[model samples]
Target: MYVRTVYATGDPAKIDESLDALRVEAPKLLADQPGYRGYSLFADREIGKIMMGSWWESEQAQRNSDDHLKERRAALLAPFAHTVTVDSWEAVVFTPSLQVQAGAGFRLSRFDVDPSDVDLLVQTFKNTVLPKVQAIAGFEGMALLIDPAKGRGSVGAFFTDRAALVASRGAQSAARGEATAKARVTMRSIEEFEVVLVERV
Candidate 1:
């Protein structure tokens, strides 16, 4: 699996509105892309920093999406690019393994599971959370890594920018209330991070 991420800094006032726009617009725009799969977005409240993420079956699919025509794709993304910085990359090693350099702006998440409910947890994440989150705006891609043998898992997303990352949640605001309640029932521990760079094997 491969990931790409982008973000922006230096603009605080425009942050909230931009993030919300990404949450609502991205999925509707990118859902039909040939190699498209799923994606996620996030925000760091302290600095008003944002991250946009997308996941693809291979690095090539991601590259092709970038080849998208500007004029044609503008309607899908016109709202999220107000004034944000952007970066992209692929994942190497997250925890148990060492990482290789692939690109920039990669995010790695380590999720702890309940020993007694490990299998159920994995199922819920795949069946429940994944579908709901993928529909959000600024969500260009997503990938989930699981190790049932060890009862642990890791998930990643590719982004366009910090604004997109922050706005991802907004894209699904219509369903946010219900999604939150469901997550509280299923998740054990969720950890979020910022990836500086990545290397490939």
Candidate 2:
């Protein structure tokens, strides 16, 4: 699978409005696109930050949507966001216990691995970290994305709600730390967000 992520910073007050717009617009724009699989939007109202992601069946399919999505993105982002960052990645691992929906909590963790150890890192994640994460209370799903050429990867873990998220943090952190060290990866950053919208095609 291929994934595209858009990060933006905007007016906190307008965040809900922006998400509502996306909730209405994404399906109309993406539902019939070739190889379109799903899409989701997350936000951190207090920080005025939002992340929008679209999933595709393949790299070519993802690339094919870029031109069509460009204008839509501009229109939605222009009024609210002052800073925007966009990235694409290959989905390495995805485990969804339930369909993604509003009210879910997400924790995004980024890592930098040695280019030569990319496969090892991925294997370690699947063999070790993932099982532990799945066993956590309220665990809902997880997605791991990587750019092998750049040795960069990100993990997105979801929970049923904020309470579940908080309850699992300590165990999640410990497992992730061990996995990263074993894989010779460097932990970069982590961010939290609330899922506002999701659609699977």
Candidate 3:
């Protein structure tokens, strides 16, 4: 799968309005696009930050919808968002559970690994970390995306709600820390967000 991510920061007061607009408009605009799979909108209300991600069947499908996506983003988010960062990635590991949906909480972690350790990192995550994560209470789903050549990657873990998310933090942190050391990957940033919108096509 190919994924496109947009990160933005804006007025805290306007976040709800922006999300409301997105909830109404995004599906209609992207529903019929070729190879479109799913989309999610995440937000950190206190921090006034938002992250929107759309999944596609391939790079070509994402490229095909680029223009329309850009226009829609401008209409719904540009007015409120002061800064926006966009990126694309190929999904290396995707494990979805029935518990994942709107109202879930998400924890996103970015990593910088040595290029030579990319495969080991991916394998270790699947064989060790993922199993432990899935066993956690309220665990919903997870996805790992990477650009192996650049030694860059990100992991998104979904939980049932805020409480479940908070409860699992320590376990998650320890697992990630071990994985980081084992894979020789540098842990970058970790952020928490509410899953405001999630659509699977």
Candidate 4:
């Protein structure tokens, strides 16, 4: 599977309106597209930051989607978003045990890795980090997306509520350190966001 993430920021007051367009109308545009699997939206209301991720069956399908929705995509965000950035990656680990809801707690951790250790990083997550993370209280699910060529990856950790997410911060950091140490990767940033909307097709 593949994941394409779009990051955007603009007026904080326009956050709600931007989310509506991205979650409601954007899915309509993607629903019928080949290889489309799901869509998830995250937002940091304080900063007016939005992160949108869409799942596809393959890299080709993910890339081709840009050609199909280029103009429509731009127009959709024009009213509310001031700047946007996009990234593509392979879904190395995606297992959602719980269906996310509006306001669900989400934490995104990004890392920069040595391209040569990409495979090792994947293995370390599966063999070590996955089990440790699954044991965290209120952990609903987790997914690791990576771009081997760029040697960048991100982990999306989902929790049942804000309290659970807060309580697990220490554990999350420890696990992150362990994974990066073993994989020879460096942590970039880790931040929390609220899940605004989710759609599975």
- Which of the two candidates, 1 or 2, achieves a greater TM-score against the reference? 2
lDDT by candidate, in order shown: 0.49, 0.87, 0.88, 0.87
Summing lDDT over every window of 10 consecutive residues in candidate 1, give the lowest-scoring window: 96-105
How accurate locally is residue 77 in candidate 4, as Cα lDDT from 0 to 100?
74
Residue-level lDDT tens digits of model 3 in 124-196: 9999899999899999889999877788889999999999999999999988987998888998999999999
Candidate 3 global TM-score = 0.95
Lowest summed-lDDT stretch of 10 residues in model 4? 94-103
Count of residue pairs whose backbone atoms collide, per candidate: 33, 0, 0, 0
Candidate 3 residue pairs that clash: none
For candidate 1, what is the TM-score? 0.42
Q: What is the lDDT of candidate 4?
A: 0.87
The Cα RMSD in angstroms, rounded to one decimal, for candidate 1 relative to the true structure is: 13.8
lDDT of 2 by residue, 1-201 (tens): 899999999999877777777778876788768999889889999989989889999999998897788789878877678788989999988974348679889999998989888888888889999999999999989988999989898999999998898898998998898788887799999999998877766
Best by lDDT: 3
Candidate 2: worst 10 consecutive residues by lDDT? 95-104
Query: What TM-score against the true fold does each predicted structure earn?
Result: 0.42, 0.96, 0.95, 0.95
Error of model 1, residue 152, in angstroms: 24
Question: Which stretches of model 2 miss by more than 4 angstroms?
Answer: none
What's the CA RMSD for each of the models? 13.8, 1.2, 1.3, 1.3
Residue-by-residue lDDT tens digits, candidate 4, 40-135: 889998988898899999989998897797688778777778999989989998785448788888999998999999999999998888889889
